[model samples]
Each structure stands twice: as structure tokens, then as C-alpha cells.
Target: MTTLLALSDDFGSQLGKGIGAIALYAIVGLVLVLLGFYAIDWTTPGKLSDLVRTGKPNAVVVTSAGLISMAFIIVVAINNSDSDLTAGLITALVYGLVGIVVQVLAIRILEWATRIDIGTLIQSETYSPASLVVAAAHLALGLIIAVSIS
Candidate 1:
């Protein structure tokens, strides 16, 4: 009975630690996603949340793509992190921030290389081909970063 009690306590402690790690990772992921959103918003003409509220398809597509890209990076970071909790959290945070910067740079590069007015394109009420292209680019960037880190 004493052995069983010890095992139970150990299991409970490990479970608690796992839960705490998950919560920390989740918070980091959310912050990264928000940063990605703001980065997209900064590149565009208007507030992304406002455009989302107004139900603009272009805005919706770009916003969704950006958030999804952030998620990809965060997921990959978490998956590839060290087993130690503190080390894992630090690794995820650094990777996530780097992912955001890479994504923003990709967007700027796309705009510069293609001569597409991304800000004007995203403001369109109707879906634009530019939006699709940008969305694809964002996803590709995410995958590329995720793979590189892994």
C-alpha cells in the first residue's frame, strides 16, 4: 500500500507538471498568433479585426491564413522542443518569434517582387486573386520555417 501511494503521488506530480507545460505552451502560441495578426494588419491598409468584423472576404482569407501559419510554426516548435520544460518553453518562444519575422519578411518580399499592392488587395470586399496568392505564400512560409527548424 505504501508503494502504491508513492507511485500515485509520483504520477500525480508528473501529470501536474505536464499540464503546466501545456498551459505555458498554449500561452506562447496565442501570443505568437496575435503578433502575426498585428504584423499582417500593419502591412494592410486597415485594422484586420475591423475588416473581419465587416465580413470582407479578402480580409478573412488573409487573416485566416496568417493565423494558421502561426499555428503551424507553434505546433512544429512544440513538437521539436527539448524534453525539459523550461528548455522546451524557451525553444518554442524563440522559434515562434523567428517564424513571425520570417512570415512578415515573406509578405514584404511578395509585395516587392510581384508589385502587388497587398494593402489595397486585402481591402477589397470581394475575394481577390491576390488574396489567394498571399494566403498560399503565408502557408508555404510557415511550412518552410517549420521544416527548417525540425
Candidate 2:
């Protein structure tokens, strides 16, 4: 009994530092995602004008999907922890929703100002598959963030 208690105590003592390290890794992962977003924004073939005119980009879809996934994983993973689950979940959801709305709204407003038909572009076969995949992945990430992190 004494040995078991001692072992547990030793493990507990080191747990905080280990967990903090893991949190750091998560932050790093987030930064990488952000960086990737920026990279695509600058390097992609389609012009911002094109996206605005059409209000449709596979990039938006891919990122949205990834974020959705993240929200779910983060929320569900942390529910039973000592963390303030409510605050975390709320913040993640709000951030994701705001991001999605902003992207969509920007596209819509731009298309409106340019007098372009967004619906037509969306229905076109020239839509990007790769960018859409990225958007889907982000949405999945967002879902994980919503459900698991809390």
C-alpha cells in the first residue's frame, strides 16, 4: 500500500509539467494551421477578386471543415478534466462561427459590390477540389474543438 501511494505521488508530481508540454504542442499545431492558411491565401492560383466575385472558394470549405473537427475533438477530450469546460467550449464555438460567417459574408459582400453572380460560379465545374478538402478538414477540427476541449 505504501509503495503504491509513493508511486502515485511521484507520477502526479511530474504530470503537470508533462501536460503543459502537451498544451504547448497543441498551440504549435494551431500556429502551423494558421500559417498554412496564410500560405494558401498568397500562393493559390485564384485571385481574391475571383473568390469575391463568386463568393465560393474550396479553401473556405476546407478550413471550415478542419475547424469543425478540431472543435469536437477538443471539447470531448476535456469534459471530465478540472478545466473550465463551459468557457472553453463557448470560446471555441464563437471563434469558429465568427470565422465562418466572416469568410462567407466577405465573399457575399464582395460579389454584391462587383455585381457578380456568385451562384453561377458555385455551380461551375471549375471549383477547386484540394481547397475544399482543406476546408472540410478544418470544420472537422472545429467540431472537435467544440465538443472535446471543454
Candidate 3:
């Protein structure tokens, strides 16, 4: 009975530590994802949030794709990380932010090379097929980053 009690106490303490680590990582991850959202919003023309609020499908597609891409990169970074909780969170943040930047740059480069006004397409009230191209670019870039991190 005494041995069981001691084991329970040890387990409780370890559980507390694990919970704390998870909370810290979660908060950091959320912030990084928000940052990514803002970055993508800035790269594109018009207010993405406003468009989404008004039920624009093109805006929804771009924003949803960006969020998913950001989340995927962060998840991969967290999984591949083996450092202490804080260090791992920082590493994930770096990977996430860099992924966002690269994704934005890739879109801009594509816009220039292909002569497609990706920004205009994203902002259009009509459902633009070009929006899918932009969304796919982000997803492809995100997959590349996620694989590189892992």
C-alpha cells in the first residue's frame, strides 16, 4: 500500500510537468499560426478577414489553405523536435514563420512569372479559378517545408 502511494505521488508530479509543457507549446504554436495568417493577409490585396466575414468563397479558400499549411508546418516541427519544451517551441515558431514567408514569396514569384494577378484573384468577389492555384502553391510549399523539418 505504501509503495503504491509513493508511485502515485511520483506520477502526479510527472503529469503536472507534462501538462505544463503542453500548455506552453500550445500557446506558442497558436501565436505562430496567427502570425502566419497576418503574413498571408498582408501579401494579398484587400482585407481577407473582411471578405471572409462577408462570405466570399475565394477569400475562404485562400485563408483556409493558408491556415492549414501553417498548422501542418508547425505540427511537423513540433513532432520532429527533441529539445526541452521551450527550445522545441522556439524551433517550431522559427519553422512556422519561415514557412509563411516562403509561401508568400512563392506566390509573389508565381504571380510575376505567370502574369497572373493572384492578389486580384484572391480579392475578387467572384469565385476565381486562379485562387485555387494560389492555394495549391501554399500547400505545396508547406509540404516541402514540413518534409524538410522532419
lDDT of 2 by residue, 24-57 (tens): 5465446534543444344334543355456565
Which portions of model 2 show Cα errors greater than 4 Å? 1-7, 45-150
lDDT of 1 by residue, 1-150 (tens): 355434664898889998998899889888888887888788767888898899989889988888898788889988998899899989988988888888788877976888878778777878887888888888888888888879
lDDT of 3 by residue, 1-150 (tens): 355434664898889989998998888788978888888788778888898889788889888988888888888878876678767777877776776787678767866777877667766778988778777877877888778878
Give every collision pair in model 1. Answer: none
Better of 2 and 3 by TM-score: 3
Q: What is the lDDT of residue 134 in candidate 1?
A: 81
Per-model TM-score versus the true fold:
0.89, 0.35, 0.86
lDDT of each: 0.83, 0.46, 0.79
lDDT minimum window of 10 residues, candidate 2: 73-82
Decreasing TM-score order of the candidates: 1, 3, 2
Q: Of the pair 1 and 3, which is ahead by lDDT? A: 1
Candidate 1 clashes: the total is 0
Tell me which of candidates 2 and 3 scores higher on lDDT: 3
